[model samples]
Target: MSLPDPPAPIVHPAEYAFGDQVASAEEHLVGQVDQLLRTRFGKPVEAHLAAPTATDFAALRRWYGERAKGWQPLPDVEGAAKAGRGQGFGFSHGDQAFVMVWLTRDAAEGANPVTILRYGKAG
Candidate 1:
């Protein structure tokens, strides 16, 4: 059977933090994350599947815990999951910041998804 068409790209409004700015600001952040992934990993990421469950977050925390200390979960923002797609990927930018993204499950399995992006101090 043919696969369903992927959902249209949705950047959850609540998660985006550009106050009174145009949508392009959020788009720009996504673009920066994309660029960082491509340059650092030497490949393109296609989607970021959502992980909205405690189990999902726990697994992610475990993984991060392996690499560093003081790892903390980002708060769940409205619409961040985007149809229940979960947070799937993350990286650190030097010693200053950590970035995470959520992806659709299909995208997580088949490709890359940079759906939800959040960054905070690296610890």
Candidate 2:
């Protein structure tokens, strides 16, 4: 699904687990998230298939997560699991997207999990 030129705010910050992606509870708007618009879909939401493949993850990291405009990080920021870092791919269903992500059961209080995509060295 295509997001707005400036993606709408965390209207629904609640994410659920599927295989395609991971999310953190503490959500914040990372710079450049607006630039990255389109990400490939592994299977349609209707299919309810397994998560993305390793190859897909690599591409997303290289493109959606690190290289391209990069991942926006979440379905619902408020609902994410607490504190830590993880990675994954984008899985879009209509207006919603559930990305691939690695998750640890728990983390430090207020730590707030989030994904860190690649960035160019500051000039």
Candidate 3:
């Protein structure tokens, strides 16, 4: 199945530390997700791909009745070079998803720890 081109790379501010080391984090993420889909489901006739956002994480926490304790995306990446500038991804097929989350809050290098969660379509 064919998919629309991924969204344009996020134009980060000068202060955002998505440097050369992790410059292609977004592309890497899309590639990772695509690889997973191809390996497991061979791509779907109808698929949805979305870049994760700060609001998305916050909503997840809120949806689960969790309270935030002074957490924020660091303006400069510090821990790991990741697509943590709310630039990771999520792919959904039907009612299920293979979602990616940044473990390190706002990586100092515009990249952070990545966690992928699979739901609904386990098989």
Best by TM-score: 1
Tens-digit lDDT track of model 1 for 1-123: 111112323332334332333234344445555454444334332323323222244455455546645443333321333323333334343433244544323332433333433332311
Q: Give the TM-score of candidate 3.
A: 0.28
Q: Mind sharing the TM-score for model 2?
A: 0.21
Residues 31-76, candidate 2: write the lDDT tens digits. 1231242243222221111232222334433444332233354443
Better of 1 and 3 by lDDT: 1
TM-scores of all models?
Answer: 0.30, 0.21, 0.28
TM-score, predicted candidate 1 vs. hidden true structure: 0.30
| lDDT per residue as tens, model 3, 39-120 | 5445423222332333344454343222212222222222222433333344444444444434333433343333344534
Candidate 1: where is the Cα deviation over 4 Å? 1-60, 77-95, 105-109, 114-123
Candidates' lDDT values, in order?
0.38, 0.30, 0.37
Give the lDDT of residue 48 in candidate 3.
29
lDDT ranking of the models:
1, 3, 2
Model 2 weakest lDDT span, ten residues long: 4-13
Top candidate, metric lDDT: 1
Query: Superposing all C-alpha atoms, what RMSD in Å does each candidate have to the true structure?
Result: 13.2, 14.3, 11.6
Q: Estimate the overall C-alpha local distance difference test score of candidate 1.
A: 0.38
